[model samples]
Target: MKPGQQDNMREDIYQEIQKQKAMSREKEAVGKLAGRIMHDFNNVIGAIEGYAALISSETADPVVREDAEQIRAICAKASRLTKELRNIAAPWEPESESRSSETTAVLSDKKVSCKILLVEDEDSLRKASTRILSKVGYQVFEAENAEQAFEIFKKENPDILFTDIVMPGKSGTELARELKDSKPRLKVLFTSGYVNEKGKIEEINSNTGLFIHKPYDYEALMKMIGGLCAEAQA
Candidate 1:
Protein backbone atom coordinates (compact mmCIF):
# COMPACT_ATOMS: atom_id res chain seq x y z
CA MET A 1 0.00 0.00 0.00
CA LYS A 2 1.06 3.59 -0.60
CA PRO A 3 2.19 5.63 2.45
CA GLY A 4 -0.86 7.98 2.28
CA GLN A 5 -3.23 5.00 2.06
CA GLN A 6 -1.51 3.36 5.04
CA ASP A 7 -1.85 6.56 7.12
CA ASN A 8 -5.55 6.84 6.20
CA MET A 9 -6.11 3.19 7.20
CA ARG A 10 -4.45 3.78 10.54
CA GLU A 11 -6.60 6.87 11.15
CA ASP A 12 -9.69 4.87 10.30
CA ILE A 13 -8.64 2.12 12.71
CA TYR A 14 -8.06 4.69 15.46
CA GLN A 15 -11.50 6.20 14.93
CA GLU A 16 -13.08 2.75 15.08
CA ILE A 17 -11.34 2.01 18.38
CA GLN A 18 -12.48 5.31 19.81
CA LYS A 19 -16.05 4.55 18.76
CA GLN A 20 -15.90 1.15 20.41
CA LYS A 21 -14.57 2.65 23.63
CA ALA A 22 -17.40 5.18 23.73
CA MET A 23 -19.96 2.42 23.21
CA SER A 24 -18.43 0.36 26.01
CA ARG A 25 -18.58 3.32 28.38
CA GLU A 26 -22.22 3.87 27.50
CA LYS A 27 -23.01 0.23 28.22
CA GLU A 28 -21.31 0.45 31.59
CA ALA A 29 -23.29 3.57 32.49
CA VAL A 30 -26.55 1.85 31.60
CA GLY A 31 -25.62 -1.12 33.78
CA LYS A 32 -24.81 1.15 36.71
CA LEU A 33 -28.14 2.96 36.36
CA ALA A 34 -29.97 -0.35 36.23
CA GLY A 35 -28.27 -1.48 39.41
CA ARG A 36 -29.19 1.72 41.23
CA ILE A 37 -32.83 1.45 40.19
CA MET A 38 -32.93 -2.18 41.24
CA HIS A 39 -31.43 -1.43 44.65
CA ASP A 40 -33.89 1.40 45.36
CA PHE A 41 -36.86 -0.58 44.09
CA ASN A 42 -35.83 -3.47 46.30
CA ASN A 43 -35.94 -1.20 49.36
CA VAL A 44 -39.39 0.03 48.37
CA ILE A 45 -40.59 -3.53 47.93
CA GLY A 46 -39.23 -4.45 51.36
CA ALA A 47 -41.21 -1.61 52.92
CA ILE A 48 -44.36 -2.74 51.17
CA GLU A 49 -43.80 -6.33 52.25
CA GLY A 50 -43.37 -5.27 55.87
CA TYR A 51 -46.54 -3.17 55.81
CA ALA A 52 -48.51 -6.00 54.19
CA ALA A 53 -47.29 -8.47 56.79
CA LEU A 54 -48.25 -6.08 59.58
CA ILE A 55 -51.72 -5.65 58.10
CA SER A 56 -52.10 -9.41 57.70
CA SER A 57 -51.47 -9.95 61.41
CA GLU A 58 -53.45 -6.94 62.69
CA THR A 59 -56.57 -7.22 60.50
CA ALA A 60 -59.48 -9.02 62.18
CA ASP A 61 -61.36 -9.59 58.87
CA PRO A 62 -60.50 -12.70 56.84
CA VAL A 63 -61.08 -10.69 53.63
CA VAL A 64 -58.47 -8.09 54.60
CA ARG A 65 -56.05 -10.79 55.62
CA GLU A 66 -56.40 -12.47 52.24
CA ASP A 67 -55.76 -9.15 50.47
CA ALA A 68 -52.61 -8.60 52.52
CA GLU A 69 -51.48 -12.12 51.75
CA GLN A 70 -51.87 -11.42 48.04
CA ILE A 71 -49.83 -8.26 48.37
CA ARG A 72 -47.11 -10.17 50.17
CA ALA A 73 -46.94 -12.76 47.38
CA ILE A 74 -46.60 -10.02 44.75
CA CYS A 75 -43.81 -8.37 46.73
CA ALA A 76 -41.99 -11.71 46.98
CA LYS A 77 -41.81 -11.96 43.19
CA ALA A 78 -40.45 -8.40 42.99
CA SER A 79 -37.92 -9.25 45.65
CA ARG A 80 -36.54 -12.11 43.56
CA LEU A 81 -36.04 -9.86 40.54
CA THR A 82 -34.39 -7.19 42.68
CA LYS A 83 -32.05 -9.81 44.06
CA GLU A 84 -30.98 -10.64 40.52
CA LEU A 85 -30.47 -6.96 39.91
CA ARG A 86 -28.35 -6.65 43.02
CA ASN A 87 -26.16 -9.42 41.72
CA ILE A 88 -25.65 -7.58 38.44
CA ALA A 89 -25.40 -4.13 40.04
CA ALA A 90 -22.85 -5.12 42.61
CA PRO A 91 -20.83 -7.90 41.01
CA TRP A 92 -17.79 -6.43 42.76
CA GLU A 93 -19.39 -6.30 46.21
CA PRO A 94 -17.28 -9.13 47.66
CA GLU A 95 -14.01 -7.43 46.85
CA SER A 96 -14.81 -3.98 48.22
CA GLU A 97 -15.35 -4.69 51.92
CA SER A 98 -11.70 -4.40 52.88
CA ARG A 99 -11.21 -1.28 50.75
CA SER A 100 -14.37 0.24 52.15
CA SER A 101 -13.30 -0.39 55.75
CA GLU A 102 -9.91 1.21 55.16
CA THR A 103 -11.48 4.13 53.31
CA THR A 104 -13.99 4.74 56.10
CA ALA A 105 -11.19 4.87 58.66
CA VAL A 106 -9.15 7.29 56.57
CA LEU A 107 -12.17 9.49 55.92
CA SER A 108 -13.17 9.32 59.56
CA ASP A 109 -10.08 11.27 60.49
CA LYS A 110 -9.76 13.66 57.52
CA LYS A 111 -13.32 14.97 57.96
CA VAL A 112 -14.28 17.26 55.10
CA SER A 113 -15.73 20.47 56.50
CA CYS A 114 -17.67 21.87 53.49
CA LYS A 115 -21.40 21.71 52.85
CA ILE A 116 -22.30 20.67 49.24
CA LEU A 117 -25.55 20.85 47.30
CA LEU A 118 -25.75 18.06 44.68
CA VAL A 119 -28.42 18.35 41.98
CA GLU A 120 -29.22 15.69 39.40
CA ASP A 121 -32.49 14.86 37.66
CA GLU A 122 -31.86 11.13 37.57
CA ASP A 123 -32.83 9.51 40.86
CA SER A 124 -30.22 6.74 40.66
CA LEU A 125 -27.34 9.09 39.87
CA ARG A 126 -28.47 11.56 42.54
CA LYS A 127 -28.68 8.86 45.19
CA ALA A 128 -25.37 7.24 44.23
CA SER A 129 -23.53 10.57 44.12
CA THR A 130 -24.99 11.66 47.47
CA ARG A 131 -24.00 8.37 49.09
CA ILE A 132 -20.41 8.63 47.84
CA LEU A 133 -19.97 12.22 49.03
CA SER A 134 -21.53 11.46 52.40
CA LYS A 135 -19.32 8.40 52.82
CA VAL A 136 -16.25 10.51 52.10
CA GLY A 137 -17.09 12.88 55.01
CA TYR A 138 -18.61 15.78 53.01
CA GLN A 139 -22.05 17.01 54.05
CA VAL A 140 -24.07 16.55 50.81
CA PHE A 141 -27.65 17.70 50.20
CA GLU A 142 -29.34 16.25 47.09
CA ALA A 143 -32.01 17.63 44.77
CA GLU A 144 -33.72 16.35 41.60
CA ASN A 145 -33.96 19.67 39.83
CA ALA A 146 -32.71 23.25 39.88
CA GLU A 147 -35.82 24.49 41.72
CA GLN A 148 -35.45 21.94 44.50
CA ALA A 149 -31.72 22.65 44.58
CA PHE A 150 -32.39 26.35 45.08
CA GLU A 151 -34.65 25.57 48.00
CA ILE A 152 -31.95 23.41 49.59
CA PHE A 153 -29.30 26.01 48.89
CA LYS A 154 -31.33 28.63 50.73
CA LYS A 155 -31.77 26.40 53.74
CA GLU A 156 -28.30 24.86 53.68
CA ASN A 157 -26.19 27.81 52.44
CA PRO A 158 -23.84 25.18 51.13
CA ASP A 159 -20.27 26.19 50.35
CA ILE A 160 -20.28 24.43 46.96
CA LEU A 161 -22.78 23.50 44.22
CA PHE A 162 -22.04 20.18 42.45
CA THR A 163 -24.71 19.85 39.78
CA ASP A 164 -25.57 17.98 36.60
CA ILE A 165 -25.37 20.34 33.65
CA VAL A 166 -28.64 19.20 32.07
CA MET A 167 -31.69 19.01 34.33
CA PRO A 168 -35.45 19.56 34.25
CA GLY A 169 -36.96 23.04 34.96
CA LYS A 170 -33.80 25.19 34.94
CA SER A 171 -30.45 23.94 33.63
CA GLY A 172 -27.44 23.76 35.95
CA THR A 173 -25.86 26.76 34.27
CA GLU A 174 -28.89 28.93 34.95
CA LEU A 175 -29.05 27.76 38.54
CA ALA A 176 -25.37 28.46 39.08
CA ARG A 177 -25.69 31.90 37.46
CA GLU A 178 -28.67 32.93 39.59
CA LEU A 179 -27.10 31.65 42.78
CA LYS A 180 -23.74 33.21 42.02
CA ASP A 181 -25.43 36.55 41.48
CA SER A 182 -26.38 36.47 45.12
CA LYS A 183 -23.29 34.65 46.45
CA PRO A 184 -20.43 35.56 44.14
CA ARG A 185 -17.97 33.44 46.06
CA LEU A 186 -19.97 30.21 45.65
CA LYS A 187 -17.74 27.52 44.07
CA VAL A 188 -19.38 25.27 41.46
CA LEU A 189 -18.64 21.89 39.82
CA PHE A 190 -20.66 20.86 36.77
CA THR A 191 -21.31 17.27 35.67
CA SER A 192 -23.26 15.86 32.69
CA GLY A 193 -23.70 12.96 30.27
CA TYR A 194 -24.31 15.14 27.25
CA VAL A 195 -23.37 18.50 25.75
CA ASN A 196 -24.80 20.17 22.60
CA GLU A 197 -23.21 21.94 19.64
CA LYS A 198 -24.14 25.29 21.23
CA GLY A 199 -21.64 24.77 24.02
CA LYS A 200 -24.26 25.41 26.70
CA ILE A 201 -21.93 23.98 29.33
CA GLU A 202 -19.20 26.43 28.46
CA GLU A 203 -21.63 29.19 29.38
CA ILE A 204 -21.26 28.33 33.07
CA ASN A 205 -19.73 31.29 34.92
CA SER A 206 -16.07 31.99 34.15
CA ASN A 207 -15.22 31.55 37.82
CA THR A 208 -16.37 27.91 37.83
CA GLY A 209 -14.70 24.77 36.46
CA LEU A 210 -15.35 22.52 33.43
CA PHE A 211 -17.94 19.73 33.21
CA ILE A 212 -17.11 16.45 34.94
CA HIS A 213 -18.43 13.71 32.64
CA LYS A 214 -21.09 11.31 33.85
CA PRO A 215 -20.48 7.73 35.07
CA TYR A 216 -17.53 8.88 37.16
CA ASP A 217 -16.01 6.46 39.66
CA TYR A 218 -15.66 7.27 43.36
CA GLU A 219 -12.07 8.40 42.93
CA ALA A 220 -12.99 10.96 40.25
CA LEU A 221 -15.92 12.14 42.36
CA MET A 222 -13.69 12.55 45.41
CA LYS A 223 -11.10 14.42 43.36
CA MET A 224 -13.72 16.86 42.05
CA ILE A 225 -15.21 17.35 45.50
CA GLY A 226 -11.77 17.86 47.05
CA GLY A 227 -10.83 20.40 44.40
CA LEU A 228 -14.04 22.39 44.81
CA CYS A 229 -13.82 22.30 48.60
CA ALA A 230 -10.18 23.33 48.61
CA GLU A 231 -10.99 26.23 46.27
CA ALA A 232 -13.81 27.36 48.53
CA GLN A 233 -11.61 27.20 51.63
CA ALA A 234 -8.83 29.12 49.89
Candidate 2:
Protein backbone atom coordinates (compact mmCIF):
# COMPACT_ATOMS: atom_id res chain seq x y z
CA MET A 1 0.00 0.00 0.00
CA LYS A 2 1.07 3.60 -0.60
CA PRO A 3 2.45 5.44 2.45
CA GLY A 4 -0.34 8.11 2.24
CA GLN A 5 -3.05 5.42 2.10
CA GLN A 6 -1.51 3.57 5.09
CA ASP A 7 -1.44 6.75 7.16
CA ASN A 8 -5.13 7.53 6.43
CA MET A 9 -6.19 3.97 7.28
CA ARG A 10 -4.43 4.14 10.69
CA GLU A 11 -6.09 7.47 11.50
CA ASP A 12 -9.51 6.03 10.60
CA ILE A 13 -8.95 3.02 12.88
CA TYR A 14 -7.87 5.25 15.79
CA GLN A 15 -10.96 7.46 15.39
CA GLU A 16 -13.23 4.46 15.35
CA ILE A 17 -11.62 3.13 18.51
CA GLN A 18 -12.08 6.50 20.25
CA LYS A 19 -15.70 6.64 19.15
CA GLN A 20 -16.37 3.18 20.58
CA LYS A 21 -14.76 4.13 23.88
CA ALA A 22 -16.90 7.25 24.13
CA MET A 23 -20.04 5.23 23.48
CA SER A 24 -19.04 2.74 26.17
CA ARG A 25 -18.56 5.51 28.72
CA GLU A 26 -21.91 7.02 27.85
CA LYS A 27 -23.60 3.64 28.27
CA GLU A 28 -22.04 3.17 31.69
CA ALA A 29 -23.25 6.55 32.86
CA VAL A 30 -26.77 5.86 31.68
CA GLY A 31 -26.77 2.49 33.39
CA LYS A 32 -25.69 4.01 36.71
CA LEU A 33 -28.41 6.65 36.48
CA ALA A 34 -31.05 4.07 35.62
CA GLY A 35 -29.98 1.95 38.57
CA ARG A 36 -30.41 4.85 40.95
CA ILE A 37 -33.80 5.80 39.58
CA MET A 38 -35.06 2.24 39.62
CA HIS A 39 -33.92 1.70 43.16
CA ASP A 40 -35.92 4.71 44.38
CA PHE A 41 -38.93 3.90 42.22
CA ASN A 42 -39.08 0.30 43.41
CA ASN A 43 -38.93 1.43 47.03
CA VAL A 44 -41.96 3.63 46.46
CA ILE A 45 -43.86 0.84 44.78
CA GLY A 46 -43.05 -1.53 47.64
CA ALA A 47 -44.33 0.94 50.20
CA ILE A 48 -47.58 1.47 48.31
CA GLU A 49 -48.09 -2.24 47.89
CA GLY A 50 -47.47 -2.90 51.54
CA TYR A 51 -49.98 -0.27 52.60
CA ALA A 52 -52.51 -1.68 50.17
CA ALA A 53 -52.01 -5.13 51.65
CA LEU A 54 -52.63 -3.73 55.09
CA ILE A 55 -55.83 -2.07 53.93
CA SER A 56 -57.05 -5.20 52.21
CA SER A 57 -56.45 -7.36 55.25
CA GLU A 58 -57.72 -4.96 57.91
CA THR A 59 -60.85 -3.72 56.21
CA ALA A 60 -64.02 -5.77 56.28
CA ASP A 61 -65.73 -3.62 53.65
CA PRO A 62 -65.70 -5.27 50.25
CA VAL A 63 -65.38 -1.94 48.47
CA VAL A 64 -62.30 -0.98 50.44
CA ARG A 65 -60.74 -4.35 49.83
CA GLU A 66 -61.44 -4.00 46.12
CA ASP A 67 -59.76 -0.62 46.04
CA ALA A 68 -56.70 -1.94 47.82
CA GLU A 69 -56.51 -4.81 45.36
CA GLN A 70 -56.62 -2.33 42.50
CA ILE A 71 -53.69 -0.46 44.01
CA ARG A 72 -51.66 -3.65 44.20
CA ALA A 73 -52.51 -4.39 40.57
CA ILE A 74 -51.22 -0.98 39.60
CA CYS A 75 -48.02 -1.57 41.57
CA ALA A 76 -47.50 -4.79 39.68
CA LYS A 77 -47.79 -2.94 36.39
CA ALA A 78 -45.35 -0.29 37.56
CA SER A 79 -42.95 -3.01 38.65
CA ARG A 80 -42.89 -4.37 35.11
CA LEU A 81 -41.97 -0.96 33.74
CA THR A 82 -39.05 -0.72 36.15
CA LYS A 83 -37.93 -4.15 35.01
CA GLU A 84 -37.98 -2.95 31.40
CA LEU A 85 -35.88 0.04 32.37
CA ARG A 86 -33.40 -2.29 34.01
CA ASN A 87 -33.15 -4.29 30.82
CA ILE A 88 -32.56 -1.20 28.74
CA ALA A 89 -29.88 -0.09 31.16
CA ALA A 90 -28.02 -3.40 31.31
CA PRO A 91 -29.45 -6.18 29.28
CA TRP A 92 -28.83 -9.75 30.38
CA GLU A 93 -30.10 -13.24 29.78
CA PRO A 94 -33.00 -14.62 31.78
CA GLU A 95 -32.55 -16.45 35.05
CA SER A 96 -31.33 -19.99 35.10
CA GLU A 97 -33.83 -22.84 35.37
CA SER A 98 -32.93 -23.55 38.96
CA ARG A 99 -33.26 -19.93 39.93
CA SER A 100 -36.61 -19.68 38.16
CA SER A 101 -37.88 -22.69 40.04
CA GLU A 102 -36.77 -21.23 43.34
CA THR A 103 -38.69 -18.00 42.76
CA THR A 104 -41.84 -19.69 41.41
CA ALA A 105 -42.03 -22.56 43.86
CA VAL A 106 -45.49 -23.55 45.04
CA LEU A 107 -46.40 -21.57 48.14
CA SER A 108 -48.12 -22.98 51.17
CA ASP A 109 -50.37 -21.64 53.92
CA LYS A 110 -48.17 -23.37 56.50
CA LYS A 111 -46.59 -20.83 58.77
CA VAL A 112 -42.80 -20.64 58.56
CA SER A 113 -41.07 -20.68 61.93
CA CYS A 114 -37.81 -18.93 61.23
CA LYS A 115 -35.98 -15.71 62.09
CA ILE A 116 -35.22 -13.47 59.08
CA LEU A 117 -32.74 -10.59 58.96
CA LEU A 118 -33.86 -8.13 56.28
CA VAL A 119 -31.28 -5.53 55.27
CA GLU A 120 -31.93 -2.78 52.80
CA ASP A 121 -30.66 0.77 52.47
CA GLU A 122 -34.04 2.08 51.40
CA ASP A 123 -36.15 2.73 54.49
CA SER A 124 -39.55 2.40 52.86
CA LEU A 125 -38.68 -0.81 51.12
CA ARG A 126 -37.16 -2.32 54.24
CA LYS A 127 -40.16 -1.46 56.39
CA ALA A 128 -42.61 -2.71 53.81
CA SER A 129 -40.84 -6.01 53.41
CA THR A 130 -40.58 -6.44 57.16
CA ARG A 131 -44.28 -5.73 57.67
CA ILE A 132 -45.35 -8.06 54.91
CA LEU A 133 -43.17 -10.86 56.19
CA SER A 134 -44.22 -10.34 59.78
CA LYS A 135 -47.87 -10.42 58.84
CA VAL A 136 -47.35 -13.85 57.35
CA GLY A 137 -45.91 -15.19 60.64
CA TYR A 138 -42.22 -14.83 59.82
CA GLN A 139 -40.06 -13.29 62.53
CA VAL A 140 -38.42 -10.48 60.59
CA PHE A 141 -35.70 -8.14 61.84
CA GLU A 142 -34.93 -5.24 59.58
CA ALA A 143 -31.92 -2.90 59.23
CA GLU A 144 -31.40 0.08 56.99
CA ASN A 145 -27.87 -0.80 55.98
CA ALA A 146 -25.17 -3.43 56.32
CA GLU A 147 -23.68 -1.90 59.46
CA GLN A 148 -26.93 -2.33 61.37
CA ALA A 149 -27.46 -5.65 59.67
CA PHE A 150 -24.19 -6.98 61.06
CA GLU A 151 -25.24 -6.01 64.58
CA ILE A 152 -28.59 -7.70 64.11
CA PHE A 153 -27.00 -10.75 62.60
CA LYS A 154 -24.71 -11.12 65.59
CA LYS A 155 -27.65 -10.96 67.97
CA GLU A 156 -30.36 -12.71 65.96
CA ASN A 157 -28.33 -15.33 64.11
CA PRO A 158 -31.20 -15.35 61.71
CA ASP A 159 -32.13 -18.38 59.70
CA ILE A 160 -32.08 -16.41 56.47
CA LEU A 161 -30.46 -13.12 55.42
CA PHE A 162 -32.69 -11.17 53.06
CA THR A 163 -30.79 -8.11 51.85
CA ASP A 164 -30.49 -5.63 49.03
CA ILE A 165 -27.32 -6.14 46.99
CA VAL A 166 -26.20 -2.52 46.62
CA MET A 167 -26.28 -0.50 49.83
CA PRO A 168 -24.59 2.79 50.78
CA GLY A 169 -21.53 1.52 52.64
CA LYS A 170 -21.16 -2.23 52.76
CA SER A 171 -22.83 -4.13 49.96
CA GLY A 172 -25.17 -6.96 50.84
CA THR A 173 -22.86 -9.52 49.27
CA GLU A 174 -20.01 -8.29 51.42
CA LEU A 175 -22.13 -8.55 54.57
CA ALA A 176 -23.28 -12.00 53.59
CA ARG A 177 -19.73 -13.14 53.03
CA GLU A 178 -18.61 -11.84 56.41
CA LEU A 179 -21.57 -13.40 58.18
CA LYS A 180 -21.21 -16.67 56.33
CA ASP A 181 -17.60 -16.94 57.39
CA SER A 182 -18.84 -17.28 60.95
CA LYS A 183 -21.90 -19.32 60.07
CA PRO A 184 -21.28 -21.28 56.91
CA ARG A 185 -24.77 -22.73 56.70
CA LEU A 186 -26.44 -19.34 56.84
CA LYS A 187 -28.97 -19.00 54.04
CA VAL A 188 -28.98 -15.76 52.07
CA LEU A 189 -31.55 -14.16 49.80
CA PHE A 190 -30.37 -11.04 47.96
CA THR A 191 -32.64 -8.45 46.35
CA SER A 192 -31.92 -5.52 44.07
CA GLY A 193 -33.42 -3.35 41.33
CA TYR A 194 -30.06 -2.37 39.83
CA VAL A 195 -29.06 -4.47 36.86
CA ASN A 196 -25.60 -2.88 36.96
CA GLU A 197 -24.79 -5.29 39.78
CA LYS A 198 -25.48 -8.26 37.58
CA GLY A 199 -21.97 -9.57 38.13
CA LYS A 200 -22.39 -9.60 41.90
CA ILE A 201 -25.80 -11.19 41.54
CA GLU A 202 -24.54 -13.94 39.28
CA GLU A 203 -21.76 -14.61 41.76
CA ILE A 204 -24.31 -14.90 44.56
CA ASN A 205 -26.49 -17.30 42.60
CA SER A 206 -23.53 -19.41 41.61
CA ASN A 207 -22.53 -19.68 45.26
CA THR A 208 -25.93 -21.22 46.17
CA GLY A 209 -27.39 -17.98 47.41
CA LEU A 210 -30.86 -16.79 46.31
CA PHE A 211 -31.88 -13.52 44.64
CA ILE A 212 -35.14 -11.80 43.79
CA HIS A 213 -35.55 -8.70 41.71
CA LYS A 214 -36.98 -5.57 43.28
CA PRO A 215 -40.69 -4.66 43.03
CA TYR A 216 -41.51 -8.31 43.59
CA ASP A 217 -45.04 -9.01 44.82
CA TYR A 218 -45.84 -10.47 48.23
CA GLU A 219 -46.42 -13.90 46.82
CA ALA A 220 -43.13 -13.97 44.96
CA LEU A 221 -41.25 -12.75 48.00
CA MET A 222 -42.92 -15.34 50.18
CA LYS A 223 -42.07 -18.09 47.75
CA MET A 224 -38.37 -17.19 47.94
CA ILE A 225 -38.42 -16.91 51.73
CA GLY A 226 -40.36 -20.11 52.18
CA GLY A 227 -37.97 -21.98 49.94
CA LEU A 228 -34.98 -20.64 51.86
CA CYS A 229 -36.55 -21.44 55.23
CA ALA A 230 -37.20 -24.98 54.12
CA GLU A 231 -33.63 -25.32 52.94
CA ALA A 232 -32.39 -23.95 56.22
CA GLN A 233 -34.28 -26.61 58.08
CA ALA A 234 -32.97 -29.31 55.82
Indicate which candidate wins on lDDT.
Answer: 2
Which RMSD does model 2 reach against the true structure? 3.7
What value of lDDT does candidate 1 attain over all alpha carbons?
A: 0.65
Rate residue 7 of model 2 by lDDT.
100
Question: How many pairs in model 2 have backbone atoms within 3 A of each other, for residues 3 or more apart or on separate chains, i.e. clashes?
Answer: 0
Off by over 4 Å in 1: 1-109, 205-207
User: What are the per-residue Cα lDDT tens digits for candidate 2 across 47-118?
Assistant: 887777767766789999888878887887887787778778877723411211121122223467899999
Estimated TM-score for each candidate:
0.54, 0.88
- What is the per-residue lDDT of model 1 for residues 97-197, given as tens digits with 9 covering 90 to 100? 11011122222335788999988776655765565567557899988998898899889999899887766689888888898887888888876543432
Backbone-clash count (model 1): 0
After superposition, the stretches of candidate 2 with alpha carbons farther than 4 Å from their true spots are 93-110
